[model samples]
Target chain A: MANFPENIVPSEMKNFRISIDDFIEAYNKGEAELVDIRVPMETKVWQVNFGLKIPANELPKRLDELPKDKLIAVACPHTDRSNMARVYLAEQGFNVKYLVGGLLGLMERLKGGMAKDINL
Target chain B: MKEISFDDYLKSFDYDERKAMKIKLNEMLKLYEEGKAEIIDIRFKDEYEAWHLGFGKNIPLNELPNRIDELDKNKTIVTVCPHYDRAEIARLFLKLKGFNARYLTDGLLGTVDYLRGDKARDYIAKIKGES
Candidate 1:
């Protein structure tokens, strides 16, 4: 079993999440790295076109693949799994935050002609 | 190998599918005590650490792929989460992968609410005493 994360306290949780808008802004500036944490079964149905594809369960062994300098923005279809990953990453000492609205909301934001905002 | 496709799973959806996809909390508890069910809490590890049902295995939804081997094929597999949403997701995935799986329709919190105080103690004592 994995050890419980060391970020349960309120003071540490204040910076646990980021809004979709802020994430988009950071994406444009290349100041953040988005990690899609969906499982293979779910990813087979719907998926994001860009971002690092790392399953949450495989993250412990894949830490070297992540960039330490950039702000790591972890996301799943919803906020649930991303929040879990954020706690784990924080304890491992990475600058991280979960996307508030999640990957589903992120995709929804980029729908229609608004995709150009991120140069997609 | 991928045993079943999403389209096939969706194509088979109907009233019978709905009935087959879920297991009530009481039935789940009974089957678990009878050694005929394996309850998997499919929430994340952090959520499991914060609080949990104190029984069943805590396998996060994302980890289900790697941990499939840990599950027993002979027993009924029941997936659970805070609400029924994630549980449903895990159930569908397990079913597609060929496990006789079901979601907790009343949910894990609902199960916890049902087994409070005297009910919880009696249930625990019975299981332990029987074993």
Candidate 2:
């Protein structure tokens, strides 16, 4: 994760914090753009089927790779780094959101099979 | 514990009856990834704790009656066990309870085999190719 400024609060960003259920729904509908902000090593074990992996430190240089029109959702192993990414992206003029519980929450949902209906 | 005869167990359900409750692994995986189905492991609690599918809840076959309330009726329920025996029974019971349900054709062992194979790698490569 990148070193975020100490004073940057989540409220400072326009990015929305989305729940795991909503994230899965957006992913299933092909309406969400995901950015895995974890390091490369984290992906070797597991990764979402959709998304580009641009680590938080590398994001500034890789901003050109992200789609401008899509609603971007940043994810990390936990929400802290994704929250940082969200703030950064929002400042860059992109429509962005941070996954509330990040990848761990997603893995839990997958394990429990308890996510709300994707269509609903 | 005395084991029941496999032959006698086979006679418990008719051919078409058994077939209707079974779901192919590929189909279950599809529903799982698409977020349309829930994987419910019907194995013993210890067996599930030892190892089980990465996604889904575990409500052992013996405990299903008491824990049935834990399941969501809105999503398709996919029951799994080491083999299909317990899973099939669980599937039928869930269906009777008015939840859409099916059992993994060969259960957890088959699902593990499938995951261990190249299918997961192929899926990752396919996703990379598209990106």
Candidate 3:
């Protein structure tokens, strides 16, 4: 995991944690946007609904294309790239939230027979 | 092979020492039931359809990059393959690419083994419904 400075932000911001249920709820309500940070090649085998592509390396230059006002949730095949992106955006003064556990986390949530109940 | 520096080698230590998730098959079954994790079948399309764990996503490692958009990034992902080599490689690749990924130690058959028992049937049933 990436290390964060002890006093990087106020307690509330520092302790912010997004759960799978929260993502599903937002997705179900169509209030959140899911952006996949994995490269195009990685997205071919399996993909989520309404998910967009913007590889992690290209995120910095493509910032303008993203909706700043909307609740943006970024993810990668794994959490490492997404975490890095989250930290980068947070540093740049953008209020973007990352999907915890990455794609795997979502799958886990779905496999336990909660697929239909997925908020989105 | 080209000569490598010690620092570079040290930095790559995690990649070299990578191992599968240490959880037991039964535990994985429980987690699956609780929607806490998902099984990912990393075999090729043909190999996967012939026989799979019954609950994991069939995402061929080579095809992962192109189809990555289909995955829900908020969940935990555990990749499974015949042995664990490809899954480990895929895990490292995803880590480098920024995903929270892990390789399943039990492989596809292990999941099947867990599913065969009465205790894991409900979990297996749940997985089947989702897939």
TM-score of each prediction: 0.52, 0.42, 0.43
Candidate 2 whole-model C-alpha lDDT, 0 to 1: 0.68
- What RMSD does each model have against the real structure? 10.3, 22.3, 16.3
Fnat score for model 3: 0.00
Q: In candidate 1, what are the lDDT values of residues A1-120, reduced to their tens digit?
A: 222322233344447788898988998798888999776677888878878988776677788999899899999886756765675677678999999888989989998989877744
Task: Order the candidates by DockQ, highest first.
Answer: 1, 3, 2
Model number with the top lDDT: 1
lDDT string for model 3 (B2-45, tens) is 33332232244332232332345566666666777766776677
Instruction: Indicate the DockQ of the complex predicted as candidate 1.
Output: 0.03
Supply candidate 2's per-residue lDDT for A42. 70
The chain B TM-scores of all candidates, as shown, are 0.93, 0.74, 0.72
Order of candidate numbers by lDDT, starting with the best: 1, 2, 3
* Pairs in steric clash, model 2: A111-B56
* Candidates 2 and 3, the one with greater DockQ: 3
**DockQ each:** 0.03, 0.01, 0.01
Q: Which candidate leads the pack in TM-score?
A: 1
lDDT of 1 by residue, B18-60 (tens): 4687899999999998889999998778889999976889988
